[model samples]
Target: MGREQEELWDAETAREYDTPGTGMFAPEVLGPTVERLAALADGGAALEFAIGTGRVAVPLARRGVPVTGIDLSRPMIDRLRAKADGATIPVVVGDMATATAPGTFRLVYLVFNTIANLLTQDAQVACFRNAARHLTPGGRFVIELWVPELRKLPPGRQAVVCRVETGYIGLDTYDTLHQHVVSHHFTFGAGRDARLFRTPHRYIWPAELDLMARLAGFALESRHADWNGTEFTAESPSHVSVYRLPHDG
Candidate 1:
């Protein structure tokens, strides 16, 4: 990741990143995610790409699935260290696409649309190769990503509201030509200025992601609409995909 993009998720954002027991951190969302990953680890060590704030790693580790992480944000890693031991869930503060962690893993996973953070086809491809580098033969690499919502865009429209609540709202604006989406988050409070934070992502289609995996010497293993093992269909908004390296390789 570039300096500009790294700075986008500075300390302030890291501090507010964890929303325990609600939103993405809710038991309903996180539990199944960690469960499936733990199952994939299959009693072996695992590696996480862009593992932020111990959201999934902590619980997975508590389950006795040895977990390690590679991320780019020091502040985010600091927050994770505050929640868990750095020695137990060790993290390397560098780009996940290129950073090296010691040893091979039974499973290497990336979650929560983090693959899109690389922002370029080459970088995304490099990420798959990096995951392949870390995984044991026949090991799996999983990713959770939102399917592009381009069909929801009306003709000549480029923005949509993705979330609305009492104190927060999320708006995503598309750059269709470049296949980019910038999410603008607005938080409101009584007698205070509305706070805004934005994040940009380069979204990828499932087909393209599969091709990237293939280029990295992996084959698509499975895909589901969510962590519950639900069937993926045309209407599913997001997908959890698994890719595996050849046992011989």
Candidate 2:
């Protein structure tokens, strides 16, 4: 997260973060995801990594689950606190990669595409290590991230679309020979209101993610295409990976 980007993601903006597209994150997804996690936890407290705006935490709490959230953005947590149900959550303002909270949990959750913010293998892997430190033996860490870079065009060519309301439409062109991926984020609001945010990310494959989990002392336990326990496959569109720590975790 860049300094400028951080400012944009500050409290005021975060308060309306999900207002633009609230339907994208369905209770359908949240419901099943928490149900599976609850079963795995057998009714224990769960820790949410990068629990932005308490989207998942608030609902899970409503379901009678105990959850603690950690986030790097005070603005995000502040917005979360403004919610009627959000105040029930105990949120710590700190980096998810190294922040420590009060106690060990049976479940740790990192939802949405937040992992992309790490932007590096080492940083991403460090997130796993941090989760391990907070989990009890046989505790589970759940993660949800996009499948991979999607093809804007069938061919290797990249497509550029004009900014529209809601958000920008664009793609970062990657040069495989250079081993880098450029992120092109287009922001579209009202008329003639458009902005673009671009950054680079080191994309990782499933096998690489599994390897990182192993390095962090976690073993891959289950993989799902969605929160509903759909089979993970090439066409699944997203991933839900569950990793477990030993009894000594």
Candidate 3:
């Protein structure tokens, strides 16, 4: 795990963290995702780890699912609280791996690949254990992340432009290493401000995640490639894995 990168998540970045995805259409991209998470949670209480800017929490709450959130960034939570009726949702500033609220939850969710920000195997495993501890009997822990690094290897490493707008082109670089892969994002704009966002993510196969869940005392309940219920396969780009707690002793 990298220490310097972890510290980069302080106030400054948290303030502008929503720049890339904070437009009016942000809810369009996030609302459906929250809906899927809401169903997995069984329409009860839901907890979100790293609920940045209430992007997922607010809409989930609008769906009648009482949502709570925990984040390491105070400014992010502040932005969330500043929204209309955002204060209605309870939020705590703490680390997801070690923080537990007063009560158990029917659904615990971590989305938008936030788990990778932990940057350590132990922290990742601790997140699993913490999620397990927060769930009620037969509760579910749902996560949305990308697939293994193996798919974006060799020939697939070629730089691909994802989004282009107003003379700006977004380029991505993929580096496949011994175990994990790193993505370098370079946003170029003609006569405009150019920026770079370097994000290193840990990739895990379905089998590996199943083992991790087993170790955390949860069992794999469902695995899908996307929020639309697409089948999970080797070629799938993303994953939505659900792990459930035992119903009885």
Candidate 4:
């Protein structure tokens, strides 16, 4: 993980992460992701990379799938431990790119664009390699990522407003040449002042991600627009991709 990302997700941020009830922790958001991951586990152990606050891990564990997690943020893991027992869902507090836990897993996953947080192509490739290293033969790796919305930016424009709501606003600025983006988020509530947060990411295309998987000795098994297995079309804004190691590996 980048130094900037490490500092961005501090104790305070971890405390307020799930309160918004938007995005990942929303009422209806986590169900499909957990369901899909559980199915992918196929009665085997699962590992989560960058598993902040156990958003998916806790529920997936509840579904009878053994789950482990690795994260860079101590506070995030603290929050997770507060919700779930350490023995039920063990977590390693370290960078996901190189963190290791005991034993291999049948399924390894990174969700909610966490791969972009690596901030460099080399680091991203290292992450793929790390995932492959931790998997048993024929085990799968999954990623959920947003497709770059470059079309939304008119010619010569460098920024776009992605969301505007009653109490929150979101924007993203792009660096086309470097394939980097910084997302700016602002949230406010009645009688409360607005708080702003910024996170940097290096966006990647699907083909580029496939190459990384190949270099890591994995093959693309499936790609979907969502967790329900919807076919990935050109118009899809995001994707859920599954990759698998060779059976003989």
Candidate 5:
């Protein structure tokens, strides 16, 4: 993990993580993600990279797919342990790019743009290789990532406001030359001063990701615009991609 990433998701962030109720924990949002992952598990075990707060893993475990997780934040994993038995859905507290958990799995997945958190191309490629190391031959590795919307930036503009709401604002500034972005989030409440959080990410294109998978000994199996299996087109905002290792390997 990058130094910026290590300090960004601190204990305070972990405590306030699910409070917004608009992220991975939201039913309307998490349902389809879990459903897609469960289906891919094929009654075998699944491993989640960056499984924070058990948001998807808990429900996926309830669906009867054995699930384990690896995350960098102990506070985040502590929160997850509050929601699940330690033995039922074990978690390793370390960088997902290199962390190892017991046993192999039929499916290894990273979702909700977690791969971007690595903040470097080399780290991201190592993450793909790590995912491959944990999968059984012919097993699948899935990733859900946002397609970079660089077009939204006007000429000479490096920043874009992606969201504005009653009490919150979200903005991103891009380093186009390096394919890096830093997200700034501000939230306000009555009688309280606004709070700000920033996280860095290295955005990746679909073609580049496929190349990383190839370097890691996996082949592109499928790509979709969403979890429901919509076709990926030029205008899609995000994608769900699946890769597979050769069965003969």
Candidate 6:
């Protein structure tokens, strides 16, 4: 994250970031995520990239796997600290691509398409290398990202509406030439005007992600449609990918 990103995810954004008991916060949605990450942690410490507001980190910590995080936004980390002690759930405030945290870990994971937030090929690649540098031998790096919807975009169309729920809307505009997409979120409530938040991302194919992992001294361990290990098919909208470093290297 940088100046622009920090501004986009500022205090107001952090305040509204959590949607408890519904949407992403629903037990059904978050439980599976925490369960999978806990299993991946394998009784060792875990490192989270861009640990926003401690949503998954908190529950994962409750599962008894020690957790550390690196993030660029102090405001988001502040929100997390409000929920859990900085000493108990340590966080280093810096860019996930280059920030260093103490000690090695059994797992390094980035969820909610945070890897796409790097917004460039080189930065995303560097993120992979960073995760590798922070992991012990044979440790795993996990990422959850949406598969690009390029196939649905007709000729000359640049944007698509991804979600349209009551009082909320999500849209994405693509720039295929640059491998970029901007996510636009609209939120509305009673007696209030709708608010919009936009984030830019660099869309990546699974093959390219694999290549980046390989470049960073990792091999593809597994990929699935979601946390429960659903088989990933061509039509799947998103994927949870696991990559591993060589034990001997």
Point to the candidate with the largest lDDT: 6
Question: What tens-digit string does per-residue lDDT give for candidate 4 at 109-222?
Answer: 999999999998999999999999999999999999999999899999999898898888999999999999999999999976888899999999999999999999999999
Query: What are the per-residue Cα lDDT tens digits for candidate 2 across 114-151?
Result: 76677667778988999999999898988887655544
Scored by lDDT, model 2 comes in at 0.75
Extract clashing residue pairs from model 6.
none
Model 5, residue 145: C-alpha shift (Å): 0.4
Clashing pairs in 1: none
What lDDT tens digits, residue by residue, belong to model 6 across residues 74-177? 88999999889987899998999999999999999999999999988999999999999999999999999999999989999999999999888999999999
What TM-score, over all chains together, does every model reach?
A: 0.97, 0.83, 0.84, 0.95, 0.95, 0.97
Q: How accurate locally, in lDDT, is each candidate?
A: 0.93, 0.75, 0.75, 0.93, 0.92, 0.94
Q: What digit string (tens of lDDT, one per residue) describes model 1 on residues 142-243?
A: 999999999889999999999899999999999999888999999999867899999999999999999999999999999999999999999999999999
Candidate 6, residue 35: CA error in Å?
1.0
Give the poorly placed runs of model 4, Cα more than 4 Å off.
Answer: 20-22, 189-193
Segments in model 3 whose C-alpha atoms lie over 4 Å from true places? 1-6, 19-28, 84-87, 155-178
lDDT by residue (tens digit), candidate 5, 29-60 = 88898899999998899999999988889999
Q: Tell me how candidate 6 scores on lDDT.
A: 0.94
Superposed on all Cα atoms, the candidates' RMSDs to the truth, in angstroms, are 1.1, 3.5, 3.3, 1.7, 1.6, 1.3
* Backbone clash count, each prediction separately: 0, 2, 0, 0, 0, 0
Candidate closer to the true structure by TM-score (higher is better), 5 or 6:
6
